[model samples]
Target: MARKRLLLAALAGVCVWGQAVPDSPGPAVGARVPGFDLADQTGQSRNLHSLFGPKGLMLVFFRSADW
Candidate 1:
C-alpha cells in the first residue's frame, strides 16, 4: 500500500509540473536575458555579459524528480 501511494503521488506531481502561470512566465525563448551578477562556484563574481558567446548563452536547468 505504501508503494502504491508513492506511485500515485509521483503521477500527480508530473501532471501539474508543466502548467505555466501566466503572470510569472519566465524569459521566453529567443528573448534576451536581463543583466544579473552572481557568484560562481569558484567564488568569482560573474554576469550574463561575461558569459556571452559568438552566438549567445544557453542556460540549462536540471530539475530532479526527487523535488
Candidate 2:
C-alpha cells in the first residue's frame, strides 16, 4: 500500500510539472482579441478582421496542457 501511494504521488508530481507555462492567462469572456497577421494553415496571411463573417467571428484557442 505504501509503495502504491508513493508511486501515485510521484505520478501526480510529474503530471503537474509537465504542464505548459504561458506568459499570462487567456482573455476574459467576450473580450476582443488583438489584431494579428499570421500565416494560416495554407500558408496564406490572415488577420482577425479578415475572417469576420456577416455575424462577426468567434475564435477559439486550444493548447495542450502538457505539450
Candidate 3:
C-alpha cells in the first residue's frame, strides 16, 4: 500500500510538469490586443497608448540580436 501511494505521487508530479504553458498570449482567433510600453529604435521610450492615442495597435515578435 505504501509503495502504491508513492508511485501515484510520483506520477502526479510528472503529469503536472508535462503540461504546457503558452509562450505567446492573446489574439487566439482575431482579438484586439492590449496596450503596452516598450523602447524605440533610437533608444527612445515608446508606448502603445502614445502611438495609438485613440486608435488600436498590432505587434509582431521576432528573433534578433541574439534575443
Candidate 4:
C-alpha cells in the first residue's frame, strides 16, 4: 500500500513536470529585426543597421570558447 502510494505520488509529480509553461514568442525566420545598439569590442556603441553589408547582415552565435 505504501509502495503503491509512493508510485502514484511520483507519477503525479511527473505529470505536473511534463506540462508546458507559457513563454513569450521570439523573432521568427525572415522577420525584420527592430534593430538594436550594442557595445563593440572597443567598448564603442554601434547600431545593427550601420553594420549591414551589401548582401545584408548575418548574425552568428558561439556556444562557448571551451566547447
Looking at model 3, how many pairs of residues clash?
Answer: 0
Which parts of model 3 have CA positions greater than 4 angstroms off?
Answer: 1-25, 52-58
lDDT of 4 at 39: 89
Pairs of residues clashing in candidate 1:
none
Per-model lDDT: 0.72, 0.76, 0.65, 0.72
lDDT leader: 2
| Candidate 3 vs. true structure, TM-score | 0.38
- Candidate 3 structure quality by residue, lDDT tens digits, 1-67: 8767866866776688865534234565466566677888887888766776355545566668674
Write one digit per residue (lDDT tens) for candidate 2, span 1-67: 9767866867776688966554235775478768999898799999898999999877877775477
Query: How accurate locally is residue 14 in candidate 1, as Cα lDDT from 0 to 100?
Result: 66
- Which 10 consecutive residues of model 2 have the lowest summed lDDT? 20-29
lDDT of 1 by residue, 1-67 (tens): 9767866766676677855435324775467767889887799999889988999777765576477
Q: Can you give the lDDT of residue 17 in candidate 1?
A: 87
User: Could you give candidate 4's per-residue lDDT for residues 7-54 as a string of tens digits?
Assistant: 686777668886553332356556776878998888999899888899
* Cα RMSD, each candidate: 10.8, 10.6, 12.8, 13.3
Candidate 2 TM-score, C-alpha based: 0.49
